[model samples]
Target chain A: MKNEDKDLTRRKTIGWILRAGIGAVIAAIVVKTSRRSSGGRLVWQIDPRKCIQCGKCETACVLQQSAVKCVHGIQMCGYCKLCFGYFKPDAPRLDEAAENQICPTGALIRKFIEPPYFEYTVDEDLCTGCGLCVKGCTNFGNGSLYLQVRHDICVNCNACRIAEVCPSDAFVQVPENDPYLLKELLPRET
Target chain B: MRSNILENCMLNIGYWILAAVAMAAPLTLTAASRFPQPEFDSGYVAHKMPHPAPDFAVTPMMDILILVVALCIAVVLVRKVRSRNWILFFGLICLGWFGFIRNGCFCPIGTIQNVALSLFTGVRLPLVMGLFFAVPLIFSLLSGRVFCSVICPLGALQELFIVKPLRMPKSLDATLRIIPLIVLSVGIVCAVNGAGFIICRTDPFVGIFRQSAALPMLLTGMGVLLVGTVVARPYCRYFCPYGVLLEICSLISWKQVELTSNECINCRLCVGMCPVDAIEAPRPALSDKVRGRQFKQFLYLLVFLPIIILAGAGVGHLAGAGVAQLHPGVMLVEKWQSVEEHDEDLFPSIEAFKRSGGTIEQAKMQAAEIVGRFREGCMYSGVFIGLILGLRLLVLSKLQGRKVHQASRSRCVACGRCFSVCPNK
Candidate 1:
């Protein structure tokens, strides 16, 4: 072959090799990611039942604010003036006093609807997932307030800090499909 | 007798007091005696969390296959067939698969940030993201930007609206070319510092792909599509950081598309026809002595390239603080560091951190770490931009000896518009 023809042939061969190399690399990455995650996406979630209300969710999250959030099942709530979630057991009076408030951030807003009834509403912005209110409510009153991994806020880190520190082993690996394990949120069609 | 009357009055008052306490007790207890509060009278239930569509949720294996196929098609069309019609078919098919079926979010443009995050930070990006990021560059190395020519859904969608071609002023076009560099730099810096992907967030096509998005984002997507009708591949030419990467690789590519495979007859037919205006006419030849002098001058510029890069690094480091502020943690800490100054807009993250018992010192420390990463990212970005600019200058000064109408490898997307116009074909 002439010199120019030889150069063209050489360039073509190198191009083919480059193409093959790219293909192999892509295949390798796909296999590697699948193998690493066990062929399924790992989603971080909190189990309500086994949670000890240890207040670790507030601090252990990689995000400054933990993805774990405190949610109140309105159906489970009693709207009581002397709510165990809202007030200390030995509070001096049935009033919204600093000493009587159980939540550290005052996230639980107590609204007087009628003569004797006060509705407890959680301002999620103010809630830190400390679970002080959940603990107080679960122990003294009917278990209503609970902690759940808010899907929007959670980055779904591979290794969850809340899970590691959870005393009751409440954290469990669920598919990315059904992420949140809310106490009253349809129970995953079970 | 007086003691008996006093005892009688006390007994009567005590009975009335007891009655009042008994009556108020039931009313004080809100769901008073009920253990479980009754369900709402309206009988509303919480809705299930939205799930990815059945068609959209393909296996990882399928993702790789689709990517490989698209890449192959791009290669074959550019190097072998070189047909404009086939290229248009390829774009339409990609628009269906990547734009509608798979969703446009998982694109090379978006994945640029993913790869950057993976390299700079410990973000575990999806495997397909790595593929989408790499395949385009690999294709560009062998053939040129065939991926941008058709396989890229964002480009394909824009091409469909390329009705009336309008020439963007060369000055504005050149200045706007700096955007992709800045965008890539800012994206990497912000992502490394735990800020979310800025590119993906602002992706104009994502809203249309998903069929639903925030109102503002949807409007922006529509606006880009409208502008695309007049200006061909505005995002691909000006905004896509991945396109910038492809351009860099394509410059050193083995083979590239030309206006004509055979010799050009000095035809001005292809002039003023390029959407991106990548075509450059052959300049008049210079004498050997002057060429030698010009070559020496170019060498001096090459020697000065490193100094240019270092100066850029300095400028970047100065601007690094602004980049760091994009991060939520840094923003929150910077605002709430004093703790005494009640910040008006108390973000949810800030409030949560304060309530979580985290100290101002800890938040400040995290912010400093993020800022450090941003500074490092800025330095690297500055070096990158400076290197590209210097190389571009070097190439511009060198005279092309060829007399044929040749394609500008870096700017030609290989959309195959000039193929039919060629007499050799």
Candidate 2:
């Protein structure tokens, strides 16, 4: 009985030692890694420069309608009489006709500003994020239109399905405070 | 009037000169500069892009607080209160909060990959994720498997669905139990080699919680739940990588849930109550002769351990080459080869690579490196699995004699069903 009691005590001591050792290791890892860890919430965004306009973002998202939407850089716009982003390349005339629009969903709304310059805006409710308009703008005119993850609609899946299928690997994680990867300035050669 | 006309002519000439300079500039300049910004005569301001706010507002600190509070309640309920109904109610709350409300991301089970990746590859482990991984383990060491009992949303989800619990054969149960250790080893190996979080990718419950998963994953979740109705916490018992860690911790835990507060009446009422088959019946003491034979068998098995591990490594080395095909880089190379052979159109990935100015030679080299890493990871994982299996066999060969019906320290989830069923209570 005495020997059994001694065995029990020894086992208990070993358990305690193991627990303490594990706790210390955990503490050390936390202290060591915290400094290098990316602070704050990390949310997914797209780098406009690397995006290939693959049109996968429309169908690949976990949401019923994708969180990706076409964002126009108003400052970058050429404000041309015939905006490629707003109208198809082979449009019969520079008019706001549904068949002539580059956007399949007619999400791009063109408003007359002056005799020569036109103002373009995206209707978020109607935008399907197919990147067709983006492709048109990028190929023919100033590449101002780009797809971005709208945080309001995005559930922020751990593994973004769109990122998985992205051919150019444009998807990147940005800090929650600055989620949008906006095209503020034109890409210039260094 | 003559001076004003001269000013207008000079301004037009200056604008034409600027346009000429821009047109002559190299193509390196962005397309945006092709057309000059219209000088808005009406003083109209261009609309700046709007950054919408995120929907979920819960902070990491709040999540940690709730996790800690839930663990404490589980421990108290299991050890002190000993109410199965209360534990069930608590589990339901955890399922709602962690599963549905949080969308099931960054759970302890999935954190195993992050922790493994961080430890092996020197990747910076997020502070919140590190805490999420460690706290449950610490709690399990202090108190046996209370985390598994009520705190884990996955386990809770399974528990909620358990109906008509059927007993599995002891041999089958023990065999299936080895799968979790294998999964843990493979999961860690994949994470360390930067392959990807296989555990999170394959998590059946997370899909159900998020309500937005691929068709196969949804089908898998439904299948697991359907199986869980009879098997009782099938994922927890046979598949959860985190559960393997919790089981180890709980085995050496300082305290455990008592089946009965009073002396065992030997009525055997609680034996059948445990849905997970965690209860052990009394065993007759082994004679010295039988013990000597078992000791000899253990000694023989110990000698074969190294040979077993080497065999496993050899098999893994072969399997690794095949498994490496799962990597996207390797798949890309394979696809490129097939396209070359068949004279097919370039795939999207290949097109992107070509557009980015990456040569096929560069892609082939990257794929070769990933294959090498996969082989190394698989070999290491094989060794780990072999070691675990050997140790398990050794332990099983020399079993201890039990005096009364009791819960298995490592297996019992502390759901308190046994306590409710114990006649002595």
In model 2, the clashing pairs are: none
lDDT of 2 by residue, A82-164 (tens): 67677664554557878768798989988888768888889999999999988867765677888899998887766677887
What does candidate 1 score on TM? 0.68
Please give the DockQ score of every candidate, comma-separated.
0.11, 0.37
Which numbered prediction scores highest in DockQ against the true structure?
2
CAPRI quality of model 2: acceptable
Q: Please state the error at residue A91 of candidate 2 in Å.
A: 3.2
Measured by TM-score, the strongest candidate is 2
Report the poorest 10 consecutive residues by lDDT, candidate 1 chain A.
A33-42
Task: Give the whole-model CA lDDT for all candidates, comma-separated.
Answer: 0.71, 0.81
lDDT of 1 by residue, A21-117 (tens): 6556645544443325433344667777667677878887755677777888765676665677887644544568777688888898888766556
Native contact recovery (fnat) for each candidate is 0.08, 0.45
Q: What DockQ does predicted model 2 obtain?
A: 0.37
Interface RMSD of each: 12.0, 6.9
Deviation from native of the Cα of residue A86 in model 1, angstroms: 15
For model 2, the stretches where C-alpha displacement exceeds 4 angstroms are A36-39, A185-190, B1-27, B340-346
